[model samples]
Target: MKHITILVPDGQTSLSSVACIVGSYEMFTRANGYWSQTEAGKKNGTKELYKIELAGVSKKAEFDNGLLTVTTHVHISNISKTNLIIIPSLVRDYETAVKGNKLLIEWIEQQYKAGAEIASMCTGTFMLASAGLLDGKNCSTHWSAADTFRTLFPNVNLLADQLITDEHGIYTNGGAYSFLNLLLYLVEKYYDRQTAIFCSKIFQIEMDRQSQSAFTIFTGQKSHGDEMVKEAQAYIENNLQEKISVEQLSSIFSVGRRNFDRRFIKATGNTPVEYSQRVKIESAKKAFETSRKTINEVMYEVGYNDVKAFREVFRKITGMSPLEYRNRYNKEAVV
Candidate 1:
């Protein structure tokens, strides 16, 4: 049986951390039980395929202002070898998390070097990246953390739109409940497709969810201390109904086009044009969510006249066409 060690890190963690730790342990345990009942499992003469345990740096970890606590089954030092390591989500500031959980991070690195696959849930990618395991690997995390993750770990490829990322035996998933999909993925890999499907049915989790883009709210990056770029971002947001151009913005700001583009990208992590489209799309999304606006109406309101062009850009940014996005979000929309 493969041994799975779910790490309960010391220090502050989110409620999702609690869910991930408990949910992963239960899922794997149930998966083992379900597999045992199968005809194939009978032929193997085994009752379980995995030995699951919760390990932590401390005996207990608290959450939600100490209202809840998880008592780990074992300590990290006690486990010399593990087949897989599961790191749960942590509170937002990863630098603080890394500093506080130095021992756990070191242990994670050691385990990986010793041939264990690692899976980080949600913001747990922060810890994994802090350990340098994701330095050159592709990973996914909460979309809201994309800018911060990019700034901190530039070497790591952050696929913010993806629901799950699996490379070099290191797995990660996007925010919140999306971790369920990752569990399904690992079930299919470690067990079989049939078993994974069975679990998905029981858990009521949608299978093969590939993108989290539709759920992302694009808030422009404004922390980069560039006054000119900040003004440009403000202008784009305020004037979403107008067709604005990068050259126009540059001329208005009195900066050369090339230099303006560079500053905009450096400050906002997007070129002027990309930022403009994102801003407009974000406005269109709000209109779709709260208003009973037609797709064409919303498109025109966002400064796009051509229906085809508007649909393409909306789908590119949100992974859903304008009508589909409206129907998904607006309860009044006719599906």
Candidate 2:
């Protein structure tokens, strides 16, 4: 139900609209970069440059950043009715402090005070954090700028390990392409799963509903040393109903217990026992939502040897007991 506004700097990337439609979207351009014009140098090549028009929106141009600025005034005047503000990645001179643009920061702060959700994609997070919007909130940026972002905003809880971090109303995504994932989450949250799925299929992208950490490490290419670890993970997923132990995994991999433990930990950042527990917990969560089974039945389905132990592990990992999680997340999944 929220109306979204996307703030475009000079060199605005193309993916901003993807997030805009997830709610309602308006585009705001700043006084730098190209503004829908073709360059003369590319006229001779087979490629051609074209101008893009904004729908249902008007354009204003100005000058700032020591260059010829052409864009609308970034003030409370333009954003008074917006419910969310999105900052897409911008092309800037990284060596200099283009992030310190005063008017832009003021507009962002005004929007925040007006109770609009603040979001950023890729390097756009730099602009938000530089405006002090991300202080004390968990956020992420493109991995390439992880170190630099930390250096600039040490007060911000920079989550370099995950592709996205959503704490309260603030959302930040890492990597350039993770913008799609963030947008999908917004669609699912504000609209519905079916709408999110429709948009995903339209874009020919995988429907990624899990948190950013789920896909961060399992990208297209798997690490060679981690192959066996992945195999172990697959084995656990396939056999969530069966009890698995480190001793069994060691034999299956044809390695000693200590060697298997070390390899699994090195590859997954979790020990074999810990990883297996996570897999079982996740499986149990799914079963809890979809089946009419009771807590004991769900426990057995996920290979928990005892109901008490299952309750403890499930609570530890999910911050809720099985029944509680089901009540919160299960809603129409079960018939």
- Global lDDT of each candidate: 0.90, 0.60
RMSD (Å) of each candidate, 1 decimal: 1.4, 15.0
Task: List model 1 lDDT by residue over 133-213, tens digit each.
Answer: 998899999999988988888899899989999999899999998889999999888878888899999899999999999
| Candidate 2, residue 178: how far the Cα is off, in Å | 1.7
The lowest-lDDT stretch of 10 consecutive residues in candidate 2 is 27-36
Count clashing pairs, candidate 1.
0
- Among these predicted structures, which one has the highest lDDT? 1
Candidate 1: stretches off by over 4 Å? none
TM-score of 2: 0.47
TM-score (all chains, Cα) for each model: 0.96, 0.47
In candidate 1, list every pair of residues with a backbone clash: none
The alpha-carbon lDDT assigned to residue 227 of candidate 1 equals: 98
Candidate 2, residue 160: lDDT: 59
